[model samples]
Target: MLRALGLAVLLAATTIAAAPSASAVTRTAVGGGTGIIFRLKPTPETPTSYYICTLTAVGRDSAGNLVGLTNAHCFIDEQGNKLVGERVYRDTSPAGTAFSPAPIADSRPDLETGAIGTVTYVSTPNNLLNSGPKGLDYAVIKLDESRVAPTSTVGQVTITSIGAPPANGTRMCKEGHRTGLTCGKKLGTNGIWFTHLIWTDGGDSGSPVVSGQTLVGNAWGAQHSSPILSIIDAMNTQGGVGAGFHLAT
Candidate 1:
């Protein structure tokens, strides 16, 4: 199982105080929350395999269907619209090693290929580049529960409810496929921004941002080594306004 690495030096910019106590949860090493993201092609032809981001968590739609939360950019095409009806796969390993294991003959048997999911809903494309009035960079993928469950590899995360936008210096952390878990204080005021101490990579987008086991937001974009997260309320707002849905706690 992959464990999270700390990036202490990166958070020097912010003064994070002792955080409020949070509850605990349990999870497995693989096939849980926070996994490799992939964009499966629609055609019968060979699917283009590429690492995009992390599948933040297993969510439930308003209709009670299982779903996966991720960044809208992960499912968007060049034209800007989130790719709907696309087959996506969230592999167990952060490095996507589950897709291709060692020993060519053992690859098929060793890899967990049942992590297939579909893009069900995404917030409308808006000025997500900046902290606009709307935060619309999240997407939901209806997961095939036969494979992926509502759990995390590092540990189980009991998301009781969406949290308010974090204030500056509010201690928080996130678990990403590429960087694992990293903690820092909130920095930006325009939107939700964590201190530069928390690390992220190309495949770390869509990761879950939390504070003491509570859901805060999802990784949207980043700059200067600091990851930008969409406010949970904004995500909830978009989910309702765009898809008539609510964020699954």
Candidate 2:
């Protein structure tokens, strides 16, 4: 349960779903504000831990792969380390029609539960801190099209456009899996980070921050004082897997 308040978790983590049944008909709905959890074993003696976070967005990469966005911390280990090929699972919670991951200390992950995606790209901790004031704290997950029906809307919030961060005092809302939908006015933007009056919870990392249909940033912390990561700056600066990412149509 890392609160994910840190813009960059310590050093660098250079490391680095769910399917529906046929009878169920509808596939798992994965998009912005989706609750997701990933496991970390760390070592053989240590018990595996399930950490939860929110998915920011779902879209296609420049290479045409179905990809999703979230805070890089969601994919990292206890020490905040990440592995490139690490797997990701969904935490549909109690509201959705899917398996909810119950963390068992030493029990193996429910391999029966399908993985939604694998980590394709991450803005490493070293890179985040060194990348300047607004260091990117995001990760891109290459999703499985068969397991999910990707959409840009989360609940009542629909992300129809991607644009620059809104001006100071502009209204902003975030659709998060943990906290649901909460909104406030943008406090201000400094460098690559923007402060907001929004309230968030521990598992709300990577929640999409939007102004109307335009997505402006990603929730980066649990408190209102924590700055939001600018999505446009992150993508433009990183310029690789997540480059030119747009909301799924």
Candidate 3:
């Protein structure tokens, strides 16, 4: 596995305490919830097309802003709308259900590709940016104000509190829409860079790596060609994740 060396630094910015408490974080579904998915064209010769893969809910940032996380390759296109995007729609549940879909306005453009038409469950913001590692293969989209409202059925993941990276062999866990919830350990933490031997796959990218409700990192690429979470600190310093050179607050 390719191991990169970097130093982890404490962000000087004051931690945003106004964010939701750890108890607010919840897991609605595994590999199921309402989230945006991207479909890429097979080859240059193939007609440009895209499709919605799955719908899942990510956690809100320190600012109480909900961000959409997914695979970067999933957002590619050949012609128009190369970055295929859509909104999440939770399956309607019975009354008093614990999980529900967030309220999102129809703000996405009406179009079609590969027989798929306009996605109306959630609106696609005009300023969404690809805030993830190019080689790591992840993408993040900031949810607009109109879509930030809490959902009755959609549970949110809490960003783990920022801290020094875990030492080698430290135990950790991840709750993703695909793999449900699984546990692993910190295999390496060389300076601010390292890799883990966690078991993850394609749909697992963009899932948050947590140690108790604190945000350690988001799943990026894997160590053994599997899947792994790319530490947000490393990505911020390396200029992979976050927008306009701004790190997550």
- lDDT (0 to 1) per candidate: 0.47, 0.63, 0.35
Runs of candidate 1 with Cα error greater than 4 angstroms are: 1-33, 40-48, 94-115, 125-134, 152-161, 191-197, 223-249
Query: Per-residue CA lDDT of candidate 3, range 112-193, in tens?
Result: 2111112211212111223322244344555443323333232344442444436678766554444435557778743324
Cα lDDT of model 1 overall?
0.47
lDDT of each residue in 147-196, candidate 1, tens digit only:
44554334334444455546777776766655556667767543333333
The digit string of per-residue lDDT tens for model 2 on 1-249 reads 334532111222222223246454445678887777665345212314456677888987676778888886666655656656767767645322113322222122223345778887766431333333334567888887766778777766798777776788888888776667888888875445677888776667788888897777788763332233355456656776667676777
| Model 3 CA deviation exceeding 4 Å by range | 1-35, 39-66, 77-136, 150-157, 189-193, 221-249
Off by over 4 Å in 2: 1-26, 40-48, 95-113, 125-134, 222-240
- Where is model 3 poorest over a 10-residue stretch in terms of lDDT? 1-10
Q: Rank the candidates by lDDT, best first.
A: 2, 1, 3
lDDT of 2: 0.63
Query: What is the alpha-carbon RMSD of candidate 3 to the true structure?
Result: 15.0
RMSD of 2: 7.3
